[model samples]
Target: MDLTYVVAMGSERSLVVRPPKLNSLVELLTSHGYSVVGPILRDGVVVLDFIEKFDEALIGVESAPRPGEYRLEEHKGAVFGGPVGPMSMKRWINPPNRIAWSARPEGDQVHVDTPKPRGPRAYLGIRPCDVAARTIFGEVWPGHPDDLVIVAECTSVGETCFCSSMGTGPAAGEGADIVLTEFGEGSVLVRSRSDRGAVLLARMNGAAATEDEIESARSRVAAAAESMVRSIDSEAAREALASMPDSAVWDSVAQRCLACANCTMVCPTCFCTSINDTADLDGVVQRTIRWDSCFTPGFSEIHGGVHRDSVAARYRHWASHKLSTWWDQFGTAGCVGCGRCITWCPVGIDITEEANRIIKEVAHA
Candidate 1:
């Protein structure tokens, strides 16, 4: 396996390689001291989970199809194991629980305890939509917190994603240190997109890609993007939803809504978080941040007691944020249209179906 380095203009340095097997890939990373994690088929859903070693997992090499309603069987034909199954990036970025600090109170002096992060970690399998969601979140986390300091891993996108339509991805090739795309043959196309990535690729000896192989990697991405099923017209959607703020579209859907945070949780772009301080009887506070959703009743509490007192309004906020205000706030729509929300909503609240209705109503209005 030879490595081909591709450093596109205005982009990070990346590499493309064709690995003989999964272990070789892991061996290349672990030998360089990077901890690897990827998709694991556990608890029934193929999810992004920790892979102790290369032979430990290849779940990410398995992709889901049509919708997440059913996963495409794992084979030479399918890989790029979709995104994390509704778990917040928090699971990877922020350690499950960390003791922020510990202090000892002496007669008049207080001494605090400090702890450093474990080390760098790499997520083996990632989806393009989730990568796009991460790009949006990266901008939101200003002055990057020390907790979000894990070394980059990677994802394999699916045919069901519409990240490219949102100016996001089907190719999350830029931000990662190492990315693996399963090709038709039993070979995995590995590419490095950064200096951190270069160092990682250089370790693969034979598998480090060559300049010519980079073109082949590009072809695979171009072809896969063409195969994706779901899509949204970002330009039209932004224009249509921008003016129809108070349209009946949101309310109509609320009648059948379960008010569950399914959409937000399943949404890779969603970064709403809630924190709580657990206090001991002695008045010590243990602060922790948890993922939050706009559909949850408490998300909009304000001075008037509550601004969005109705389910319809909250639902509107969620929809409008995805289709409109998120662009105003974050410079892009909050959704990459992975359709996970529709599949996992329990009640089957199709965002695309709802958006179409709203667009139609605005046309009539």
Candidate 2:
């Protein structure tokens, strides 16, 4: 082991040694009764949702370039676990378009369609940035606008992320219980920093590590942080571009934009949504929610009007919010820089590339 992978009960409660291999490591947790959830290739993308078992899942999985191109193929044996896929924290925590409480007609009135209760969940494979996103999400979802709704406790699993740039990634998980890392084939490194996390790891088995193993895990985390290729000085860039909302940047992107909502949909933090209703055969109604994008023609439609009648206005709002207003509203930038937005933008609108161009143009002039 190159780093301290496992920390046992007793002494200082710090990192111990030699990360366990994937399966052996997982066996430790599962045997101890903690359910493990992480990434799986689904619908052609490596998404962060739930998985029943590791049997056929997490195998032959791969993720390609970002800013949002996710072309995953099956690659065998101790995969790098790749970057945070196009999936975001929303899938696991928010339960997309949750009924927000549904409704059904009572004999003479309407009754609320209370959602099924779900409880403590342990998820694996979330990148550091998503963890930060989960924290950011908490502020918006549960505190002010809505009531306290604690979705789950992510007490176990691997941490492969580079949210450092956004001050959210690179594995600073005050929000996570157990952060998992793959040390070698079939082996994993579980480090529990919190009480809940420690309890979960206590159930898993692996001989306590010698000094050698602990160091091994540390090295791997350092490597993971440095290995990140997708990052932006989100704070700096956002500040620089803040006053340029009416600049030529939006128009440039609009020229190449397809009005496709792909970027917003795949983004982990883009939370805009559209709601619609369906009537049953009996003329009853039900509501459904699907992802929404500013690029869409109707997104900004106003009374007999669209507030953003021009493609420029619509696109400008998105970039500005991601780079600007998001901070005002949530005290954080809306973008996590997962790169999914770039890879899947259909016409391939590279936001970083666009930002650079705009900055350069401004500086030159």
Candidate 3:
């Protein structure tokens, strides 16, 4: 299959390819020692998992996700219908239980060892919202491979989605090797952003997309963004949180919150972590770093006692950090607006609503 490669200004190329050729793209990445990880419907939930084949990739399966309610609905013959789910790229690459290093103490000298770095991993069907989260997380943790981002633009919005408000997507931004836009009809508009992506395109042998096809892709992405029913006033939200640290709204929100930490766990940008030392029966001690949530009691532990003892205090800290202080640290807000925190919360605690509520109350006060 010989195909023409249309060179753009710098290093960008666009190709229109048929659906089955997606498998060829996967094969190419695997041949280069990349484990292809993408969306799969497992146990009635769309999650990021290993992709052995594109047919079972769960691409067109749409998730009817609301605050505290979620179910999968089949969108037959359509690919890439589902938006962001409870899982994100963070689960596959960064991981929750990543071990930084292991040390064993023998007499006066201690032996230290770190886990060997694994091969490159390719994340297929990743949304633009989560891509934004990954970009933010990469600034802090810094050592993952660079060749593995394959973004998929959303064709439809989820019930709780608000990525459009965050300006992160419905369409992917930069930092992707390959970006796929599935516009139904068993066709996909493929854009290559790097040299590796160009190689994969050459293998698939796709032709340069027609101008009409590119226009159709743009229209699809725009429609997806407009279809989103939820949005937040992020600028107002920042001002509200910073001004009202002792806002009475925190007490109301806390009463409904279970403090189960489900929101933080599902949040793609949340990077709070904790470390602990464990000893085995074989007289070997190992230290491990694991995901931690600010909602927990021990999260703010000190010599005397826990700092944020009340649920209200913990909730305040969580919201404030995500909307306010995170900007001070990263020059941008921590949330990517995927709304997984809203959908997965047992009580349907919508962060966007809470942020708006805070702004509303503070303005009146």
Backbone atom clashes (below 3 Å) for every candidate = 19, 43, 1
lDDT tens string, model 2, 1-365?
22223554434554444433345444544555545556666776666554455434554455655443456655443343456566765765555665645566879898767657554455666666666666666664431221111111111122222255566545445666656554443344556656766665565545665555556655665675666554556765666567676778778787888777777777777767788777676546667776677878888887888778777777778877876788888877887655667777777777666666656655676
Best by TM-score: 3
TM-score, model 3 to reference = 0.92
Candidate 2: regions farther than 4 A off: 1-36, 55-61, 66-68, 73-80, 101-106, 142-162, 281-283, 362-365
Model 3 residue runs over 4 Å out of place are 1-14, 18-21, 55-59, 104-111
lDDT of each: 0.59, 0.58, 0.79
lDDT of 3: 0.79
**TM-score for candidate 1:** 0.80
Global CA lDDT of candidate 1, please?
0.59
Local error of candidate 2 at residue 230 (angstroms): 4.4
lDDT of each residue in 219-306, candidate 3, tens digit only: 9899989899988778888788999988888999989999999999999888888998887775667778899999999999999999
